[model samples]
Target: MHSPDSLYQQLQKIGTSPALTVYGEDRIELSGKVLANHIAKIANFLVDEVELEPGSRVVLDLPLHWKTFAWALAALVAGGNVVVGREKIADAEPGTVVVTSRPHGIELDSGDTVVALPLGSLALSWAGELDPGVYDGAADVMSFPDSLLFSGLGDESNASFYANAVPHVPQGRIGLVSPSVIEAISVGYSTLSSGNSLVIVGATSTADSIFATEHAESFTPPVRI
Candidate 1:
């Protein structure tokens, strides 16, 4: 078994297999190689375009979807700390970078950079007019090269950082039933760290079907709020 010290290191070992398969109103599939490219693009955008420094906090206010996964992975690869929640930008500290699906008409606090994600599989640009100062995630990411060389941070340091974020590690093919953004991120990252795949179900009723069809090792049903 290959024991990778960090989630990013594990992700680097995924190679070309299917890493994430999303089932919902839209069925999206991302292979490890393609996912890595997407992640690298986002990471480059954060580091080069936004000038995000190491240890900077990244506030994720997006849905439980592929875009969110890519954004989180990108942030981690860029050496930024990820804070997953549904909180508004006003609640975040100054200079914090916030990635969100909805940025239209929302007033952002000064010093905070907002990246607008369109959430489409191959969307090169946002559908509607974006507010001034709001960066288009897809557009900005496209400008960066896919091949990214990350260094400076060692394996032990990356391991320690990701270890605190992911407490419950998962192995093999895992399924989630209508999970929230934070839950999905945590569980998905854990699964990746263990060299496993994840199947995200959009509805609770389809949990059994997904499990049977996908041959999931474990299934997490939805919790009532």
Candidate 2:
């Protein structure tokens, strides 16, 4: 496994390449690679500095941004747990992983004193100093020959592309599939955030399908690439 510092090195490498525009009416372009770095740094802080134990659950209550992505990566790298929740934060879990999104520019509902790691906290120091080039980016890890990580790229035919299309799952891997796109995206972020070194697994159990069907949840269906 790569050292924690390696994560930062990877971030410096990617700088800021867009990830999610963050879900909103007026979306701001964010960087995925930057998010990865920020997330890794937090993980380093929690593990090396705070000394959080493996599998320790830390609840997140922040808005969607590159920083959240960083936190997820940090949690995963730290080998801790994360939980996700909606706008209203709830009672945090003790042992397992927990993560969630809370409003930014304002206080959160949890009444919890959770602060984002690294850049989030660092930004506080430079709140005014920033040039307004002030968005956090997701960590950019491509399946670089040197780097083991890879994001399924936009085009497989591009030789320089780090990733190919999200490949078709072999029948054997279908058991790990998620029933819907939301689940897959959530699962994807979970993997990136958790840094558990486990692949972003897609859980599509019978119970899961039932829940999706009952709730009318739909996964991101395969579309023409």
Per-candidate RMSD, Å: 3.4, 13.8
CA lDDT, every prediction? Answer: 0.72, 0.36
Tens digit per residue, CA lDDT, model 1, 1-225:
122225555666787777888887877877777777887888778878887877777888888888898887778777767777656455776668988888776565677788988887779988888888889988877979886756542221132443444454456888777877766766676787777778887876767877788787655533322
What TM-score would each prediction reach against the true structure?
0.85, 0.40
Clashing pairs in 1: none
TM-score, candidate 1, is: 0.85
| Model 1 Cα shift for residue 54 (angstroms) | 1.4
Please state the error at residue 35 of candidate 2 in Å: 1.9
Best by lDDT: 1
- Stretches of candidate 2 off by over 4 Å are 1-16, 23-26, 63-65, 86-187, 190-225
